[model samples]
Target: MQAFDLVSKNISQIIPIPIYVGVFVVLLFQVFPRIFIARQRSIGQSTANRPGKDSDTPNGIYDRKPSLSSLVTPDPTFSWRDNPQQIPREIKPGKYFLTMNVRKLDFNDYIIFDKRYLSEYRERQAIISNVGSARIFVAEANDAALDLCEETLMVTVDFLVTRYPSMFHRTERGVLCVDAGEEYDLVTRPWVRHPLETMCLLSGDDCILMRCCNDGVLRVAAVGLVYSLDIDWTSFVGKDLASIHRDARIPFYESAIQKSVDRYFLKLQPDKPVARANWLTQIGPELRNEKFPDEYFRHVSTIPGNTITPETVVDDLYFRVERQAMRKLPSMRGVVFKFHLYATNIWDLELEEGVPRRFAEHIRGLPESVLRQKHCLEYVDCILKVMDLMAERQEKNTTNFHN
Candidate 1:
């Protein structure tokens, strides 16, 4: 028994605790973090490189950037007719069919009013009658302006459709609309977008223009113009939201149409507020999936490339009122322009500000023809300046209010 006990102690002494300790240390410090890092790299590569992998659906719409091969349409050489010397009579807001060029259409007058002006002169019955309400600006000479916008939108749509036919190849079309809400819902709600802003189109083969205006009459003659092609959402995405995604579910070239649709409008509404700015996910066909593709999005250790970050997400919204609001005219009851720009602080979200500046630089770089129009230029500049001011105020740690 004594001899057996001595042999067992000898065996224990041969396999020292230090040997086990060394093996565990190697596994913990050297091998484990590398494995973790490899896993992280694998996840990142899978999520970032796989373009639509984050997309829950095997086939769903996504944005595609324009290629260099996209041909640029030559601008018509400037002619004396481009800018008329004598200011045309201030055309009242009503439907007109007077053809100044190759394009013509039934125009709808969208009225804008100033809320601040209405508030101060709320009780002044006499003052409201003379100036018509207070601060009001009407785009009476929008014929030339709207024409420019339409022409640009048409060209843009054609360029996008032809360049990436795979994405926008479907026979179905979509419509453009302005909505107060931000998101694309596949199950219940439809994708809503603004079709016309700085651009316009009357019809095919017709020259389209959109003019900008402020004060009692239109500002500048053929200035601040954006040139792009217009697209009908109905023709591209079907009649409503349901039809569009239902067709997209087929998961082929037809679904690619949704991709084209997303890219087309992404270019159109280049400076649009991000959905996350209001803590809202962009409602699209992607959300309809039962489970979100968690693999597509990340915690964002670094800056995100395409997707918006959660910290930068804006739960509060800021609707901007431009200096143009200074010219609002009171209506018989209220003001012409009904909506007002409402804003909230982005600082509350714990994000590094200066976002609007970065956005402005990108927007300003678009085609010169698009940015050179008088009225359109003024409005664009006004919006950009306002955006810059917002960032500036944020940096200075000051409060900004828009009335």
Candidate 2:
């Protein structure tokens, strides 16, 4: 059969042409339209639910908001200096005992302005205001120490002027002066030439100025020292704390004290001020070079009788306490260690209630190593004798009180 004729005959027999046409029309109108509509709805839902550019979508799969801290700026005026906390002001008799519990220090208790502030300020101003007297107290500043001296002096002046305006005044000539009956020009005065000299003018405390060099160690850059009990300012100016104490007959630089001192200086902050107290027996109250030379430690092995005798230890000896404080200057980026020398006669301890007994305990409890380190071993016998007499007196008083 012919191919075209054969296909035509089969189509005619299989189905009517109308049925095929109807099925095609139904699919085009109903099925195709439904599929198109369903696809459009699905797209509309997806668009409605999708997150926008400003949506709170988290970084990963969760949603998170920014922290409040990230949105706020810190207050610049709030610092450790704003509100300094209180420290124990009373000089407790047994506070420094060797066997006593280690006292905890608060960060705010570093700089203390106690009852002695006015008296000390008056004494300092008196020395600096007098031309002849000021020359004797202040050492000539070296080149290396000049910048530090100036910066330290400025900071001290600013602090005193701002904190105690009644005590310090600014003259019409732009000079900062201390009011001591007559105004003492701290800045332009002939005797008060340098910044360190100004510090001497403001406070009786001996200022040992230090700066951290490239080696990360603190060096005594300058000193405005009037009353150094033993150490010489000339010899101590250029040396690090460790090197300065290296020649001590006792192993101070090698001991734990050095480590503690270095760490304290390193971690000290501008706002926090810290003070420590150290007591030593001095021959007299003279501020000059009353002790032997720096090299005396290298030559002398034993403590001389004249240095620490029963009579000298009891009668002549002065109980010297260094109320030392270290503070960081924000502008200078250096530390200022101020030592206020407070001296009382050994016999005066008897008058202060409980001081004699507590002092005796402190001295007795000190280790042999410590005594040697402090160069107190040679005078240990004399010190013990004095302490024993005080103890006996204390016991006799206690017995009499009970009756």
Error of model 1, residue 277, in angstroms: 19
Best by lDDT: 2
* Candidate 1 whole-model C-alpha lDDT, 0 to 1: 0.29
lDDT of each: 0.29, 0.57
The clash numbers for all candidates, in the given order, read 68, 3
Candidate 1 Cα deviation (angstroms), residue 258? 40
Which window of 10 residues has the lowest lDDT sum in candidate 1? 325-334
Segments of candidate 2 deviating more than 4 angstroms = 1-144, 174-179, 182-192, 229-232, 249-252, 255-257, 287-309, 367-369, 372-376, 395-403
Residues 28-83 of candidate 2: C-alpha lDDT, one tens digit per residue: 99999999999988876775566645632211211112321232333323332334
Q: How many backbone clashes does candidate 1 have?
A: 68
Best model number under TM-score = 2
On the 0 to 100 scale, the lDDT of residue 122 in model 1 is 27
